[model samples]
Target: MRYCIERLDGQHCLFVDGRKELLIYLKQASSETITDIRKVYRNGVSDSVLEIYLPYRKQ
Candidate 1:
């Protein structure tokens, strides 16, 4: 399975294996500002995908 990660600023998309391990890894690496972490599924199946909206960047 393939997992897609969309950055908060909509500037990048990362693809990874769709698995709990991968998600956990990301969570661990993320900072506290990483909010709105969500998992996306297709037809109720784990798509191994997550969408994270980080705190908005300061100009």
Candidate 2:
């Protein structure tokens, strides 16, 4: 599988190859929190990646 995410500024897009680890991250991160943000790109891009803000990362 192929994954793509856009930057917060609506400038660049992030491409991720669907390896096992990333797939798991994506699935688990789906239920995380997201603050109000502007939608820039609707295609293979993201306004923000929520995994960074996950509480589990502090460990």
Candidate 3:
């Protein structure tokens, strides 16, 4: 399985895999949310890669 993550805003995130969709709610996420994301591949013999984008890190 492969996917891509995009930060919708400061309180929401979206994970997209090809045509599949997985919405991640971060309303209660803390500062550590940036590193609390996980992606796993379960399908075999597939040409896909998981792409994850963490929330904007405050500098």
The number of clashing residue pairs in each candidate reads 0, 2, 0
Report model 3's TM-score to 2 decimal places.
0.25
Q: On residues 1-59, what C-alpha lDDT tens digit does candidate 2 reach at each position?
A: 44454444446544555445444544554322322222235464535444443443222
Tens digits of per-residue lDDT, candidate 1, 1-59, equal: 55555555546555556566445656555543332333556664543212332322221
Ranking under lDDT, best-scoring first?
Answer: 1, 2, 3
Candidate with maximal lDDT: 1
Instruction: Tell me the whole-model lDDT of each prediction, alpha carbons only.
Output: 0.46, 0.41, 0.38
Better of 1 and 2 by TM-score: 1
Cα displacement (Å) at residue 21, model 3: 9.8
Regions of candidate 3 where Cα sits further than 4 Å from its true position:
1-24, 43-52, 56-59
Poorest stretch of ten by lDDT in candidate 2 = 30-39
- Candidate 1 clashes between residue pairs 3 or more apart in a chain or in different chains: none
> RMSDs, each prediction?
7.2, 8.1, 9.0
